[model samples]
Target: MAKIYDFNYKYGEQKVVLPPGKYLLECWGAAGGGGCKITDTNLRSKGGYSKGELTLKKETALYIYTGEKGSNYAPTFNGGGKAMMHEGLSNGETLYCNGGGATDIRLIGGSWDNEQGLLSRIIVAGGGGRNNFETKGGDGGGDAGGDGSKADSKGTQTNGGKGQVGLDGSFGKGGSAVSPSSRENYGGGGGGWYGGGSGYNAGGGSGYVLTENSYKPAGYIPTKEYWLENTSMTVGGGIAEENGKAKITLLQGLPFLVISSYTSEQAVFTAGHTEENKLSKIEWFIDDVLKEAFTTDLYLEKTINYTLEDNALHTLKIVVTDINNMTYEKVVTISKSIMPLPTNANLQDISTKLTEIGEGFKNGKTSIINILALKNIDSSLNNTLVELSEKIKALFDSGDASIENLMNQLIQANNTITQLNSKYKYATGTTEVQKFSGKANMYGGKYGNTFDRNINDWIKIDNLGFVPNIFYAEHENVTVNSVFYKCVVFAICNIPIFSNEQDFTIDTSFSKEKLDNVDFRAAGIVCTNNERDVYINQNGVCIPASNNYFNLHYRWHAIKFI
Candidate 1:
């Protein structure tokens, strides 16, 4: 049996002292503000408990990352870089860099008038590559500006001309604008009339970032910074509109884990964004101890090898400064389990199953969800299979007719898919399935590509799990007149969303008589595939008459009677 270390939120960062006697570990997590709860908490906490304080165990740190990312109901183990990179918000997915850790890196919030964000490094909101009869708006995005042909190569420049509204039509769009200053790796920018090259880290217009504030995004806060480089949002290249705005803001940081203990000739991390930023130079260290430094544009990613010396448990922190000078830090510890059988085969099998099902579905072909769901029960995966078996049995039960049960089965299937997060392109790939276990396959680089995964991050998009916003009433199921106060004072925090509840509030006022009248109003959640809507008391689902709630009396719209 493993020892359990209970957490309590008492300080910003907490340290636990254990007895000398060694014991097995069950579950452990880092305590940020004092002794924090390992489970979940109110909206005031955002319940993003990611940092794992390993009490001597293997996979402990990784579990923390998984938990934190899943806490928001996000499916991506390593984020989509949504916390800091708004350009990544194209799919409205949240991701994080497993490598860098820059100082004072905060999220700025905003929104766009467009249905989705037209954000990229070099967005072209204006006209581009237009002529007599065959021309239109410029390509809008980050890294690359609007080039005529649509090839937004980082170094290669493109020229597009504006179309003439009257008389003679305009010519090709403006030339490609390459970031000559950056001689390093960059994402290819799209083409447009006034186009730029593709490059990662190059903030684009209408580009988005995920950050929280007193209120929500698109709500309008003129006093806020709505545009700039590293400012969460950049101007779009050429968005068509008299002044049509396409705003994108931060939802939260992508969840990530750092493996500092496995530093080989190269340092490495397990993240999805690494492919986005192909690294060339790697600066590594351990507690200020200079471990190594290298430069190679072929693949700027670093790798961590499990060496004999690293067999012992030792705290290690590696700070990687990518080409953009954006530094990332990952802290990891060596575990006792030095060697183990790689599950690449099992993971690949699962991926293949999903791919087949997805392809069949997309092509309007037949799909056996039952068989697909059974793939999760591969006997090789012991415990998980057992748990799933029980759930599957429930699916056939007479009570399975209920919508809740059906939805629960889908949720279980989704969770099963999540377990297939072994590696990207495990088998089917033009390139040898990027060796994440042995090489630096986009663990941290912005130029790294986000390969196709078995399950999409969309499963956990906007996954700020069941946050109970403040309702005027404090008890269990709140009321309608009080529904006006759901997270009103404080926008439910995402990344570090809440410093403390004392910093926020809601409109809680109900007269004793009015409160009595406020019946049948209950707080609950309505679930979709991955998105969940939380409604406080008296909002939607009315509380049953047999309400098991902590009822009380108060002055209607009561003010602190001084």
Candidate 2:
């Protein structure tokens, strides 16, 4: 036994520089103190990795150095607080976490058993993409799933052993026809080192976390009138832990800023692959042709990054370009999901995906001075188009068809921008609209419409064939002098699946939590256009539009197609 840091430790349990004397270090496995071994010179076990520090010395009577952690439990890896080694370290002493984190982890004189914990960082590799529509699930990615490391074992990966990240979707054309329950038959993303993949074919996975102290901010977080989609963030370890075969090896220090909820309407596109002098460099291919080659650095964070239309599904392929330009192509597909429309949309919506607006305007074309959100009319955008169109009446009543055409253009632009922006916020710009250079329309791929996996953004409709915006026939116009032909109105209604069910769970202090389910519907209105008036009594039919949310009613007029 030796007196190190004034604490008595068993032989071989820790190593030290000697007076050239023969001494052995003992084992301090789980059998040791429940976690960090504690010598029971007085009886009973104590000491834990939670907040324990170690100090070591040599037999020369002169202090060789502080004892680096020797695979002890309390000081497992990221738990080493202060007084850590940074440069020269003893056989069992180490400083500076390899992955870049609070200097934690130390070397044990014993063997390589705990080497995985000795490193400062860890990386959980991605799992292979899942297969839907007749495709075998792609093999879990190398190191991507973080299985190369050992700590990710089941028996070993306990305490949620830091799961692997799900892989990106594959671009390989998933078989036609949405596979059973899949929204899109796109290949699923592979599991990465930290997250679990979505169970359903095209689902996403839950992310994992490993940190110095813990991942969450201490205490209760209050919810407010927030539009933020998600706000949780976490740091990760680098060592990919392995069990007998090394399960999720957490490489140790991976960068932290990249953790995101990815909730923006527009999502950026990114591609990544492991680096090194392997079979050559990895490369990317859009459809078939090569785009980029991979390198050893490819394994590092942020290999590829670009903003893409949110709610749009995209397919990309990656291949390793050898020094000879030989290719090892791998497919990666990225798809974005639409955020539920906000009752009152505003700036500062929190999302994991970064979104960008087109070069034009915040609310779309300048022609549309009014916003659909302002019009209170998703219910009205697709309606017959012109029941109570106040703006339409203003247009044609002037006896100028040109003005009527312009008004129709404005409505079309507003509706189109709303739906399109809601789907692909990145495809358009948020810059304010200051002027209108005349009438404009949108076509092909513009306004983010496409059948192929490649989703397109808004295109300005200018030339005879090109209009940045398109008109809704139901929103057709009948200027003052123009005739109003009676047409049946098929309007949409907004309903509350459940009226606010206010549940009050009271203690000494009363607290009320109200849960509301908002429901929207399209109900056919057989009334003639002439009978379309705000007063329900004048119409042959009437339906309740009450869910009681701020009066529970939809505004804006339904219209008739030209």
Query: All candidates' TM-scores?
Result: 0.19, 0.17
Q: Which portions of model 1 show Cα errors greater than 4 Å?
A: 1-214, 217-280, 286-288, 296-312, 338-562
**Model 2 TM-score on a 0 to 1 scale:** 0.17
RMSD of each: 32.8, 27.8
Q: Compared with the true structure, what per-residue lDDT tens digits does model 1 show for residues 1-562?
A: 3335442212111233332222221111110010011223210001110011112111211111100111111111111011112232334433221100000001121221111221211111221111101122222322222232223321111232221111111111112122333332122121221222222221111111222332223433222222223222122322221111121222211222344223223345543222244333454455346666655442434465433243322334555454445445554332233221123446445545434433333342121223333323446454554455356434544443443443454456556656444211111111111111111111112335422212111101121122223212232234554432221111121213233221122222223333344544333221111012222221221111111222322111111111
lDDT of 2 by residue, 1-562 (tens): 2322222222223233322111221111110011112132222111111111111211222111011221211222211111111233235432211110011112222321233322211111122222222222222222122111122311011121221222222111011111233222222222222221211121111121233332222231211211112112111111111100111111111111121222222222222212223244555544344555545564343345444443343334444443434333333333334232244543333111113111122222222111222224345342422332335334534644353365454455455545544442221221111122222111123335422211121111111221111111121223344322211222222212243321111101111222323332232212111121211211211221212112211222322111
| Residue 335 lDDT in candidate 1 | 29
Off by over 4 Å in 2: 1-39, 47-279, 287-314, 319-562
Candidate lDDT scores, in order, read 0.24, 0.23
lDDT of 2: 0.23
> What lDDT score is found at residue 348 in candidate 2?
31
